[model samples]
Target: MSGANIERREIFRAIGELAYVVAKSDRGLTPAERQVFFQIAQEELDYDSWAAQSRFELLDEVIQPSIDRAYNDALHELRKYSAYLTEDIKEKVMTVLQRVAVCCEGLSANETFVLDRVRKDLQSLG
Candidate 1:
């Protein structure tokens, strides 16, 4: 694939994984959380939500990674594509994560912690 396409895929993949991580942080991925995740992804990322949704499905169905593993994997992708992580992109990323965290119910402490770490990691990219 072309470099641009590869980067896009990687970034969206990370977004999907992050959505999984946040949703699964407390009480597992609830039906409401899943719905909100896709909705926010489509609303926030537009066409790119396809890649994110694919990754989210993969984690939810196939891999079922641990929370730490999911977070680390997404972090790795973000760092790998660090050049593409402009401020606007980071804002969108956090928006999706934050929205998902509060979607099904109030945000859990685990979600709060995960979001904080994600925010810090993304901020550190600059």
Candidate 2:
């Protein structure tokens, strides 16, 4: 979670925020979705920080306070790092989001819209 990958970790943090946005968009996040969300997030954010099969209660601790505000802030944070981001990083971020969006009951309309915005945000960077 340090050294050369610091920026990548920051991007992952933003992606985690976006994931919270999507999960909360429906007003009800299933236990199954939360599990998958953490899995995908850990994989993209920094797999090295956790064990290969790590799972704990703290994994369910991401709180999405103001959906719109947090979502916009996360997107803005990613966009702010556009110049520092590599193509590979952006792809991984999107992949983490998309992978979780498909878990649970699949992407709801709100989730899809938010995800589309995230995709556009990443794509518009370069």
Candidate 3:
């Protein structure tokens, strides 16, 4: 892949991983949360783009490897690009993380863990 394509793919995958974590943080993904994830993946990432489509197809074709590659410690990885993403996008991501933390019947242990990590990451960006 071209350098630009690789970069975009990385961004898209990061976004996807964030969405996935948010959706699954509570250990039970809601329909609304799943829809939010799909919308973000389709709209924000422009999944129709050649590069994005290729990455999406690859993800579909090989789910486990793709997920392994996409997963990262968001608190650490996200800090590197804290200045690169728009403020709105960063806020939206944080909001999503917060929402995930509260999405379960109540806040699950995993949700609290991820939420605390996200909170620390956001605080660091400030």
Candidate 4:
């Protein structure tokens, strides 16, 4: 693939990691949260939906990272692709994350905390 396509896919993969982090923050990803994650991935990621799903599956079913590790890894990828994370993209990401957070049992304190940190981190990216 072209370098631009590779970078774009990596960016979406990071978005998936962020979704997994939020969904697993409270007490692991519930069925509802997983559904919301996939739906939001399809809606928000659009052309890059497959990249996001691939990363999410890797984390959820294989790697199963800790919250801190997941968040850090996602942040790393976002930073690597900061040029593409325009305000509109950032807003879409936050929207999906918040949606996933409250989809099941409502947003937990942990989810809120992670969301806040994610917001701050993304804001600081550019």
TM-scores of the models, in the given order? 0.96, 0.76, 0.52, 0.94
Query: Using TM-score as the measure, what is the rank order of every candidate, best first?
Result: 1, 4, 2, 3
Candidate 2 lDDT over residue span 47-118, tens digit each: 632421121222235443677876777777777766667888777767877877778777788878988888
Clashing pairs counted in every model: 0, 0, 0, 0
lDDT string, candidate 4, 1-126, tens digits: 998787878888988899999999899887777877898888877888888888988998899889899989999999998987789879878987898888888889999999999999998998
**Selected candidate, larger TM-score, 2 vs 4:** 4
Give the better candidate number (1 or 2) by lDDT.
1
Model 4 CA lDDT for position 90: 90
- Name model 3 segments beyond 4 Å from true: 1-12, 28-33, 39-61, 65-77, 101-106
The Cα error of candidate 4 at residue 38, in Å, is: 0.7
Candidate 4 Cα misplacement greater than 4 A, ranges: none
lDDT of 4: 0.88
Candidate 1 residue-wise lDDT, 2-105, digit = tens: 99888978998999999899999999998778888889999999989999999998999899999899999999999999998888888988999999998877
Residue pairs whose backbone atoms clash in candidate 3: none
* Candidate 4 Cα RMSD (Å): 1.1
